[model samples]
Target: MCSSFRSLLPALRAFTAKCPPPQICTSLRTYATEAVPDFEHKPSHYGQPLFQSHPHLLRPHELTPGIPSEEYERRRKDLMDSLPSNSVVVLIAAPVKYMSGSIYKYRQGSDFWYLTGFEEPDSAVVLEKNASSRGYRMTLFSNGKDSAKEKWDGPRTGFDDALNFFKADDALTIKAFPAQLRSMISLYSNVYIDLPQSPRKNARSTKSLLRYLSPPVNPRSEYETVVESLSSSRRKPLAPHIAQLRAFKSVCEQQVMRMAADISGRSHAKTMRFTRPGISESALAAHFEYLCSLSGSQRLAYVPVVASGPNALIIHYTSNNQVVQDGEMILMDAGCEYNGYASDITRTYPANGSFTPPQRELYSAVLSAQKALVGLCTEAEGLSLHDLHRKSCDFLRRELKQIGFTLHTGDLERVLYPHFLSHPIGIDLHESSYSDRGESLKAGMVITVEPGIYVPPTAQFPKHFHNFGIRIEDEVLVGEKHPVVLSVSAPKEIADIEGACQGLLGLEPI
Candidate 1:
């Protein structure tokens, strides 16, 4: 504690407890516990002292390339070969916006990252298939340094260094895109662009990438609004093509996925040890994400679903602000994103660190079904998501029936378990590739096997399981040999989870 704080009032103690630099403020929560059941804790790391001060990104860090130049060249060549003659493809990087505070946190678009591995915002990529001239197939329009703009935005990958830094055949200011686009459109017969979906999201996506190219390009305008202005005819959707390429994982892609899975798996295990009756749902999320940040994950794949008790029955319940009860179960579905690739995993455990008999039974059903699905992970089987989902339904149904609950209606299974057994996961949490449920399993793909059973307190049947819910998810990699579980460290086995739950929580190295 700082000496200046001791002289001040106690209410302001929280503001100064970690005033000094390098003081690791590790205490999870100090607020008096509220008596509410579902919505109790609400603590985020807003005022905690800095663990370690991170200075502005040095020139060395900024100049360093994200991936090898050869890789990007290979991808562009492959995509070009697949395209018809006299065709042009355009990729727009993600847009930027001001935060409530002055801080600006930006990320590159997944598709753009896939094609170019370029991280700068307000950028566009142009790929002209079957180039008529030598050394002129690819081009980039990026933000260059303006003394006034740099004062506010910090830095830019200006045109001079753009060719070497991003390995683009040519580089120009973002302002030149409209002319470049027009010239390419006049020469090419077919044009490709990422078609907009969801008006609100679409608006933000297009504006951030194209607003810099012209005057009066408001940030709120929709993607179609911009596309209509750029070309005479409708541009075909380019995302599906990129998705096709991303669907099959390369060796480097798998390596990053494996790394992400390890970080998430270890975090789940540590969070299980941290769970107790008095701990809140938000606390668990904080702890898990804290571990992820320490482990060097760039960002979370999605919101952490720290659902406890009957709340698990509601899928995608992101309001993780509840007090975990002694006899209740905790269902957490969380993952981390690394280098634009995603790793997703889910784990269910007892709130008190040891499951009751009913919980064990429910968990066993999901576990057994997931194991059976894992067995079906071979190229010869050619099993699809629909196939795995059906198998999961059957397993849950058999388990429920054995426990003496008669699902009198055909819709009962749908009511209890609403989601599919698995979905393809890669750059996106639910990867854009293979949109259909009937898409067949293929080698070099990674997916999540999550089968859950949730019974709400309001639902009929055994009163003991009224608020009970259980789900066990794992990351699976489909290879030539078989499906490999990437997150193998997190304990899903009954005995292993129980043994871990019985010990004192390890606060550090979690």
Candidate 2:
């Protein structure tokens, strides 16, 4: 779809450049022998006839069997066990976002992905839970017009292919979602939603749904009434349950996460080797993405942070622009998603492949804090994120005091350690959890223990301390025995990182 649409764009731009807007529309309508609609009034890839051979719509079928039948059956059954009799669960995937006007790419919701494995927007899945039945009943709602969209955009899978290929019991157009809601809602007592908004309704389509459910007579009002009156009986919101499921990954999910970590780790390690005194931060950012793709990660789990020097002070710094200096540190907090699972790891290192005296001091503090926290992440009962987090702050505070950053002894101040030490990591980078505070670190849970010290651009005490930021992070999975760092193979220690810079540079000029 991307390749075909990109090809259509240049031709469309050329057509508009040579002709007036009205003339372009007339030419398009006359050639296609179709009236120009409101949507066609704007410049678009759809306006070009060169892409006629490509299909406009996408099919709701799987590329390959993503989840095995047994796995699907198992998850479906598990959901059934938790639901009440005559329960109906509505799951919708997230719609795509436009980069600017008329260009779109979307990330699917986890729940919707788990159930349907469909990526098409404006799609919804319905699961009927029954006490007597062994496997839950399933239905899918998708786009109707296949060939209609194919001429302008791309090919669609259509209902027949989606039902048979994806093993959906029944499939219908998105229009059917509203039409079928009357019966689907009346029959089932419970409706499950992770959030209030319907997945089938995008930013453009939701207003109509709200109007449909509004008090005034709209013939579709009854359908909305049924859904609204029974809205309180939603299926169990998987706040902690889904977190639990994701915490203890299946073999497949773990493999994907491990692959993501390896790719992301290599990206950071490569940056360490390739970075020099004059390289623009943007080039390094592009190089990091190239390495991520080369390592088999089709998508980055999140935006790559390539902050150099003082830019590292900004937590979510995405604009990789500043020129890295000889002695400044670069903090890169980036990761990739393998399959659908995510891996988030951060490493702060010198741009010149050597840490300065003050840089080494801060780096050692953060590393020591991480090491101390990891020791506490044992299988010991009753230890929670809150407990481990305090331990991290305490360690950091002690190290800082010893190094003369803070005058206070063991008591850490929030002005120093503001953010918490850890967060759950999985399909979502900052994955959903029960609470940010007091959440227990359970076995099978995966988290990132990142401790850092950021000294903003200032001139009070040490001049070298100003405009320098350092953070060391690793993904750790809680085991029955001990904490296992998924990113352990990556160069992290001061010695190991220097070794990687030398050895990796020896092979090729990455």
Candidate 3:
């Protein structure tokens, strides 16, 4: 899809430059007609063309299956056991998103991925407690294979292979989901759905198709029927149960996460070594993600924040399009998702391969505070993010004072650090979002110990410190006694950072 679209881009630009908006659309349609004369553009269930015109959309699926079927069974059992007797749990996979002119590689819903490790999109899973003669079981509704659609979208693992590919007790076509729901809606007393994360009804198509079609008098959603069918039954959110199970990482999960962390760490190290003036923030991010992909990272864990200079003041700043100048610090908060596990590591280094006096002072402060808090990760049963977060705050307070920055707000005596010092990181970058078991930092749990001091141009700090942002983030694995730094391969010491940055130069832009 990307290659075909790229081929059309130059002509599309030419048409747009020479014509009005209406004419541009008309020319694109004509060009598309000529470009792919064989494309039938068969509409999907939602009326959009089902990616059939693209080559390699029919390519074989490639991935490292995250865990064995037994582990998936174990997870299902744990979740079912956590729920009340005779419960019904329904989880929907994330929909495949088409971004811009291309179909994005699908990312399965975290909850769905946790239970099945299935990567295909537009699939659904149902777990019923004591539904059959057996005590518990699972049924999968998958986008079963369609030879017609396979020409453009490639092969699919639908109903025919759902049982074999995803260890479901029974499998059915996703198109048959409504009928299945009708059959199973009243089977159990305790009904559950992952409603907290599912999409809302009446969602409009993004492609602007069907706007002229007459609207229905009373639009009904697939969920309304399920909810209205069970008037006398109790309904509950299944997220907490799933979250609880996901909180405690298994041996296999830890191994995947460690690999993810290591891959992400090496990407950061590469970014450090390649740092030089006149590089764009987008370039740095591309280089880092390229390194991650070179090391077998499947996709980015989240939108990377490659903020340089004052841009770092914006927490969650993902607009990595600015030019990195010499004598300025670069803050890169990025990670990659490897085999269903996620790694989030952020490192701040100098654009010129060296930090000035004020930059080093602030960077050292954040580094010290981060290390101090990481040492506190123990199996103390009751340790929560809140407790360690407070420790980070105190550490920041002292460090900021030593660094000659005045603290004023309740969070930092100022709002210099507008983000949390720590959070859980695993299958999701903020894996805690999917977890409801508890917030205790137990063994096998992976967390990030990130402490940073952002002195944007607006902050009332020393003049030299302005527009400089320094954040040292590392993935921390909760061990028997102390936290193990999984991302230690990314250097943090000032000498080490400088040494790593000064190693090479004149690399091609990503």
Total backbone collisions for each predicted model: 0, 12, 13
- Please report the TM-score between candidate 2 and the true structure: 0.78
Q: How far is candidate 1 from the true structure (C-alpha RMSD, Å)?
A: 12.0
- Cα lDDT tens digits for candidate 1, 7-80: 45454545557575221111121112322332211221111111111112112322212234556666677777
Model 3's alpha-carbon lDDT is 0.70
How far out, in Å, is residue 205 in model 2? Answer: 13
How close is each model in CA RMSD to the real structure?
A: 12.0, 13.8, 13.3
TM-score (C-alpha) between model 3 and the true structure: 0.79
lDDT of 3 by residue, 1-510 (tens): 135644675787577587653311121112232344453433322211122332212112222333556687778887787778878887777755678979888777888888877766666778889745445788987667777877787667656456654568898876666557667857778878744322447553221111111121112354345445644436666777777778778776776677777778777877887778898999888899888886667799999999988888777899899998888788889989987888888888888888788788888888889888889887763577777877888888898888677766653635677777777877888876554324567887778888787775654667777777778888887877867787876777887677568763222223
For all predicted structures, in order, the TM-scores are: 0.80, 0.78, 0.79
Of 1 and 2, the candidate ranking higher by lDDT: 1
Q: Point out where model 2 deviates above 4 Å.
A: 1-69, 195-241, 409-412, 433-437, 457-464, 503-509
Residue pairs in candidate 1 whose N, alpha carbon or C atoms collide under 3 angstroms? none
Where is model 1 more than 4 Å wrong at Cα? 1-67, 101-104, 131-136, 195-209, 212-231, 458-460, 504-509
lDDT of each candidate versus the true structure: 0.70, 0.65, 0.70
